[model samples]
Target: MPSTTRRTAVAALALAASSVPMLAGTASASSHPSTVVSAPLAKGLYQSAYSERHHVLWATTAVGRPPVTSSALLKVDPKTLKVQATSTPPVTDAATGAVEAVYGVAVDDEHDTVWTTNTRNNSVAVYSQRTGKHLATLPNVAHAREVVVDERHDLAWASGFGDGTVVAFDTRTFKEKKRVTVPGAAPAGLAVNERTGTAYATDLKGNRLIAVSPYAKDPSFIPAGNGPISVALSPDGRTAYTADQAAGGISVVDLRKKSVTRTIPTGAGTLSVATDRRTGRVLVANRTAANVTIVDPAKATVTETLPTGPNPNHVTVAGTTAYVVDKSGAGPEGRDQVHRIRLGR
Candidate 1:
């Protein structure tokens, strides 16, 4: 049970979050006709990944702060949005005795594993995709926020938000490969080009993108919009899209030029972005506006905006379907939710 003071604080935060007004320059759901299916999941749903090989969706949930008592790794059927299996993380600390709560998740279909970021514990944990068994936990990652797996290189990369670094791990051995750091950078979202073995991270504090190559001696920086929190690459790996939280838009970057070609305004608090290979559309999750904006990257135009519940935190697209996870609920307890949207041709 939570303490009385903690409950009060949570209630106040929920009220404040609920009161946020919708921002300008975003389309309404009425303008477009699309099929949307949603389901209420566990608490503290933060990030999600879709496994095409397993035909399941992997998500992470962690509730409360230190001594996180409630947390689970969920394996869900993407078609029905039902939880197929749940696995709890192991305890990391003996004295304080805190559970390794997972906040970020990524799927490695090649190795039949799932990788998650233990943000509060400053570590990354790997689990068996088939059995949900706890495989390994690697410590010393500073404020891990996002994890991305490069199947071609057999590497899993995690963003260290606190120390302005990104750490790479060998998927086969579960060993630390290397750590790439940039001064004054606070990486929040990460994406990788599997063919090139190059990773891109959003510098939340510096308002830039850090392009990290495994073989490069020094990482290069590309300017982005204000507060780019999430990033995604196009199917051809020629373009990068970033959700600019502060600017309330998406920054489109050309990988060859290493610069932002345009910034498309979507809505308030654009927190996460994902590209749909089937339709060539870019989906941006607006946390404050309680909606997801779909853009056509070829035309640089907003085609549709789908309404989500409160505080939509992350979005991922698999095939023609898009999955979103949000933080807040109707009551003070803050039950999180997961939404699935089908993209029609």
Candidate 2:
């Protein structure tokens, strides 16, 4: 009797040990470390941001060239400004179709994964935070332009550049949960105020700003400046900024009025805009002028203009560092440099 009881306990413990992985697999994975691997893009980096958990800068390379291909995503150490890891999304065989151009990436801290959008291929790719493994691809999207992840809402919204629609996917299941139509035309940029269940899309061709209530019906468009290419919101969510490439200016829109309050002119051919919540200043990247215009929202004036590399297309504010991608040429050999601009210096 004693021997049988001991054997039964041993069997039950073995069973529990064998099922441990199966049970824990259902839970979310843990985040990985921050490290640099390659610096292939010294010049042509188009966009970058620092991951709050990983403490690394994630950058997107444009659609061109050998080293700076459309699909390349670089991870850089924030402390050292050195490349940590370089990985590409899964690509289909040429016989079937090529991989889409990855234009944007958003880290989901909840799942310990990175979500990237392939604009031309119309797909969203998920990668592991630790091993950089290709987890899966969410397909059937249309002309995906940019993506914003809302972990609190358990959703990821993508802007369709060709179809003029915005698609929302459930991050937990990676399934399309909603498809909202835009009021105007080509959806070029996207911004989401998840706190209010509101998302905004900028229509470049239509010269309007489309607003969507993620929890409600069809979205509405508010007339903004001409050729609105990029959109960003203040941390307080009281104001929004739109970068107008055609108008060569930044439209300041009051969220309460949902209308353009003012326009701040910058170098011609402005492509991207970002707001620094810490300093309360908005940064606009001007492609044609090769400068970054810093605007003080409270004062409604351009506070500073800093010179950067040739053809600076996108700018991201990471703590005290400003990462600007300068694409000198349209081809693969185009020398693009990611410059680190120390703020308040």
Candidate 3:
């Protein structure tokens, strides 16, 4: 967590209005999904997720407090781009005495809990999904990047980018249940398959993906591209696509065998990945290219590149809509933007 004074300084950078343009440009128009609308938000963008039960979208950003109070969760309308609610998730880490700077947010609609990765505090904080009230905070996951809630198994899984491990916590009691280690992997993002009782994590440093389960002796690896930062799984949990930032492509993995099936070239600086299973589309956010590449998984080829911003790093698809979060940097850290694109299907 940043100091109070530093938080105030960081808050100044996010005071921009939300009237920025919708979509920059479209390289291709398809019957799949189209750019519906993109709006400008405050800086310090991280991740976006959709709540199916509530039929709304939620996004997280890293910001200091000043003129505005600190509530990292923002409830957004999926269709109108209107900010429905902003929750100030205020909490001081009992051990560190620092407020949570949530960088990753995931919605558990069934449990009505919003799970966030408190990156600065090296922990994950849970909140009431609707009211945004602090429910619980699970500490000890050093450098936690993203968290996925397994409602069926009553578990919450997280990736420790700083410690090279994937930890799991009991959802009912918020207790440490299991930890699967991946030495030197620098695990950043993970996907949990509740039905399969397995989890897949990406190793940013090792350039591979690992599947972990309590029944397995050790984690199994799937070779991915260089600098793999994020990953997404197919609906059936049979395939996974890894966003290779350094390699500038998407690595398709056969999850059943834990092996790379193909390396599909997307574009330079592919930072994040999200899949729309119904349409068979894979979306990758190219940070260096500042665009979103819509790839057809069956063909393993890029179909369209839509302009987002200077750095489009995060993306998630809800129904026919794709929400992309961009983080700008350097001067005042002015890179908070959420671009929502609509799909035609």
Candidate 4:
């Protein structure tokens, strides 16, 4: 569980995850069929995201030292499993001043844009995915953590941990679009239904998951485990899986009923989560356990546990392949790195 001081941090089956976005899309199965790992990205790795149009994966980092400008958004070619480009999401821009700490990442294929949450700046940074250009910076995001693009509404939705709200912005105009109050005291993570614009956010203080529409007014909630840090939606979009850091398990939410259906015991420090598109399995990264647990959400049972390097904080899936991102200097593995876990291996 996170300390009272860390209630501010988080990530998620979530259509939009704090740490869990569909950062990797389904592609052809490889002939080798072995888990492929990538070298450490930096000293402070954040989120991993996938761009379908370009068939790429994006990894963001939190700059810890001087020359913080070197912190960047890494573009990985899924086909080759290699870092292709490194683009910086300007920390301080004219429109939004002093944007710092890239926390959450989400990509908009239609707009050819990539969005990142600047926690310190309380803003969202928008950049051109194709050109790696810093397009615009949106201010007043309210201690933003994770971000997601609502294509249907043509807006970007971000979780506001500091103000207990979800801030939305117009993608075209780069203006404040909506501000929906969260049910609980502290909103840490988010998951969005891209098709319906229905979003779910984790309230650590309230120990519940609040469901709301960025465009509409109806707001509802489901009881979550203690200290729910991240949330992910099932493939069917009806079930929500919240990684309860304090409860040391996952709270299975039935979106239709707006209630928790079950609690599946998991390893300690359940931080980030994502679902496998090919097998309908839920993958969770247990930070303290230094491993990833593959869960069958339908049965609410653990199927397998795979060892990760250290501080496996964020995870995403493409087909049966799972990409787990580790933080720097957390464990024996040390520096930031990514472990590719291949199921059915």
lDDT of 1 at 309: 61
Q: Which residue pairs in candidate 4 have backbone atoms (N, alpha carbon, C) closer than 3 angstroms, thus clashing?
A: 11-19, 12-20, 13-232, 13-233, 14-232, 14-233, 23-49, 23-50, 91-99
Better of 2 and 3 by TM-score: 3
Give per-residue CA lDDT, model 3, range 106-192, as digits (tens): 888878878899887788988887787889878888889998878888888899988888988877788888897776779887888
Candidate of highest TM-score = 1
lDDT per residue for candidate 4 within 150-219, as digits (tens), equals 7777888888888888777888888887787854467777888887888788888898887777657756
Per-model TM against the reference: 0.89, 0.81, 0.86, 0.82
Superior candidate under lDDT, 1 versus 4: 1
In candidate 1, residue 131 scores what lDDT?
Answer: 95
Worst 10 residues of 2 by lDDT: 19-28
Residue pair clashes in candidate 1: none
Report the error of model 4 at residue 233, Å.
0.8
Instruction: Report the lDDT of model 2 for residue 313.
Output: 70
lDDT of 2 by residue, 1-345 (tens): 001111222233233222111110000121421111111244336566557778777777655532323466778765455567877765555554445446677777787777777766677777777777777788766777777778789888888887788888888888888887654478877788878868888999987788877778878778788899998889887788999999888998887887888988877999988877687678888999766777777777776666553577777776755666667542235445554555552
On the 0 to 100 scale, the lDDT of residue 306 in model 3 is 76
| Count of clashing residue pairs in every prediction | 0, 11, 10, 9
Query: What lDDT does the true structure give each of the candidates?
Result: 0.84, 0.68, 0.76, 0.72
Model 3 vs truth, CA RMSD: 7.3
Q: Give per-model CA RMSD.
A: 7.2, 16.4, 7.3, 9.2
